[model samples]
Target: MLSTKEHADVFRELLRKGDRLYLVPVPGHSSALPEQLAAIAKNISADLELVETYADVFAALEVAVEGEKKRAIVLCGSLYLIGHFLSSINN
Candidate 1:
């Protein structure tokens, strides 16, 4: 899952073994950086791989999909991020 700090905890709840949780920064907004979010998640003993902070969702997805098997990706958080993803695909 990819999310910002506002919904990080909720997204963390949906984590499963083998899942990767990606926390990203919300540009222009005062929120926890992705690194900080990862730290917080680790503090709580969140399972799964906590990859490094990615500033771009597409970049994150690219890395996430690099394996052999098919995968399911969930993009959650602000509507702006969702819209950004949608716009990116439509381009």
Candidate 2:
């Protein structure tokens, strides 16, 4: 979806305002991956922007919620991002 201008714009808008923005990308791509998926794949852009580990992500969330009456952290992506997030915490 990031390859499409409309979808990409929507995604950008969704992350524009927040205490912190993190993008946890899938680690690697296979040849079986479609071209659009491959085009948007990278760890450095999403890679470097993401917290060093998922624990850092949760820690960021705890800090983020400190000032708000109501707040939530929205995590998006496939099982990959969630798996990465969970595995980091489990380890």
Top-scoring candidate (lDDT): 1
Cα error, candidate 1, residue 8 (Å)? 6.0
Write down the RMSD of candidate 1 (Cα, Å).
3.2
TM-score for each model? 0.71, 0.37
**lDDT for each residue of candidate 1 in 1-91, tens digit (9 for 90 to 100):** 2343444465457656656777776544554667866676665545666556798788877877788376777786566677778887999
Q: Return model 2's CA RMSD, one decimal.
A: 8.6
What are the runs in model 2 whose C-alpha is more than 4 Å off?
1-21, 29-69
Worst 10 residues of 2 by lDDT: 29-38
Per-candidate Cα lDDT values, in order, are 0.65, 0.42
Most accurate candidate by TM-score: 1
